[model samples]
Target: STGGGLADYIPFIIFGAVALIMTAVIIEVQQAVRKIPIQSAQRTVGLRQVQSRASFLPLRVNHAGVIPIIFAISVMFLPTIVANYFNAAPVDTWYYKAAHWIQGNFAPDTTNLPMAITYNVLYFVFTFAFTYFYTAITFEVHDVADNLKRYSSFIPGIRPGRPTEDYLAAVMNRVTFAGACFLGFITVILPIATAKISGIPHNQMYLGGTAILIVVGVALDTMKQLQTQLVMRQYRGFIT
Candidate 1:
């Protein structure tokens, strides 16, 4: 009995270790930003000619963060939720069969390999799709272009109007794709890998990849916000 009890906790221990590693990785990725060099047009200040101001536009790779994961999970569970209403139907009826099928295939089950595979596949698809969708909605190329133009700032080689918008959009697309792929991989691979390695049932492994991702993403974001606030307070003190 003691051996069996010890064996049961192995999956949890492995999960905790993986979660810590992933949290560190996510924090590192969140802190990384790509800086785009920009130069402001020269202006005359009274008698002296003021040199152009140099600055940079910082873009985060995972701008959407945990939002995509939340959206994806909500959408992915809809079918299963709808199927629940048909559970009371007669066993011989089509509704009953459909409900059973949905439960058996769409839901996550460690003992059922096919169900697990299908669940992971859908999870990956939803995660990847939502990552791009959320990124597009939140990060508008036109707005960024307009702001840059308004401030008389321009990228090193890029023009100030539509070309700049196009360039920004192109870069965002590439970055978003990379982030989406990483999210999908984590969502699908972690649970299966842990289950296989520890010989634990999927149902028993509660700390899946998606959960770890959301937790880490939220923690990192919170830390960033706190840091920003601290910097603002320091600036305020300096001003006074």
Candidate 2:
């Protein structure tokens, strides 16, 4: 309420809240994962051959989550910020013209068709690229394959050595591609869609897709860890 009464802000508040709720729900839906089956082969245990056991490796669809969004936003604004510094330069100079172009096209103004298209396109590309880069660094197929080989575990129908790595790499690429697309959609499209459907301006509200992604991802991970701890405690108490 900037000099206005609380009554004047009620409608804005209501619509803003609804838009944020929608963003949260959409981000939660993107948390799905692809599970790869893992079979632990029989291993000799002190003159005994233990039976094989089956398990699965869960690879999250939004493995990078908020990280890519944060990175993309930071990179997306770099040119805009830099261009502002050069606005004092001579307008006739080539560098000044370049800076002017950057400032015009890089703004996140949804009402402007050309600026919105250029900004969102770059934002999506940056988010997609960052997701794959972060995923690769975090999840290494070579290490996963080596660990499986050492533990007498192997993916069904896949060999134990290089073939296993190759298969894992292929699956990871597919999963990462899906993750990249989801990140791109969440970062670039979700906000625009929210603004269009709810009639709420994004700059005036807290309808951040990154906020929902981080909150839902962290909440789910914490809950899963807590549940596992509780289960473990039920079988083996902490005291002894």
Candidate 3:
């Protein structure tokens, strides 16, 4: 009975340890923000001559980050549902056959060479497309511009308001596109690489690409929030 109790607790312990480690890694990544100093144009309430750091603007490289992956996973699932309607019994034969072919070729299993190629192509396209979609949804250049303006901060070379917003949006779009492509490659690459490097079976090595991205992204966000809290409170940051 005691041994059974111990066994039950073991899995939780293992999972907790992994979560902690993942969290640490995420924090490290998020804290990699590059802070660019922009002196404030207006003085603050307390200061006669504004004496603030007037610096520490955060530039998040992975701003769009794993959001594109989530969008891809969610959007890609809909096609499968449409295919399922065709696959229903006593339905159109050609539709069923086409659905079967697509399923056989692209379902995460049945990785014949041809199927693998098709999967890669579809995966890349969906990932890339959703990346753009997610960037538009998540990264609001206007918000950033507004925040900067409210703080009396503006980009060094760019004019304030609409011009600054446009420049920032352009930069973000370019970076987001690059990040999206990288994620697309990574979605396919990590599982394959893990399979090659580890003794895990291919199926097991297929460690849920979307899941991985979500886990990493959530962990990173949590860490950043924690870091902000610690900074506000003027305490030592996390040890683990």
- Candidate with maximal TM-score: 1
Pitting candidate 1 against candidate 3, the one with the higher lDDT is 1
- Candidate 3: minimum summed lDDT over ten consecutive residues — where? 199-208
User: How many clashing residue pairs, candidate 3?
Assistant: 0
TM-score comparison, 1 vs 3, better candidate: 1
Tens-digit lDDT track of model 1 for 67-161: 77788779878988999999999999988898888876786663577877777788889989998999899899999999989877899899999
- Give one digit per residue, the lDDT tens place, for model 3 in 126-172: 88887777667777879988888887888788887998889877776
Cα lDDT of model 2 by residue, 151-185, tens digit: 99999999998999999889989988988988787
* RMSD per model, one decimal: 2.7, 4.0, 7.4
The TM-score of predicted model 2 comes to: 0.82
Q: What residue pairs clash in candidate 2, if any at all?
A: none
lDDT of 1 at 81: 95
TM-scores for all candidates: the values are 0.87, 0.82, 0.70
Alpha-carbon error at 178 in model 1, in Å?
Answer: 1.0
| Candidate 2 Cα outliers beyond 4 Å, as residue runs | 1-31, 87-94, 110-112, 228-239
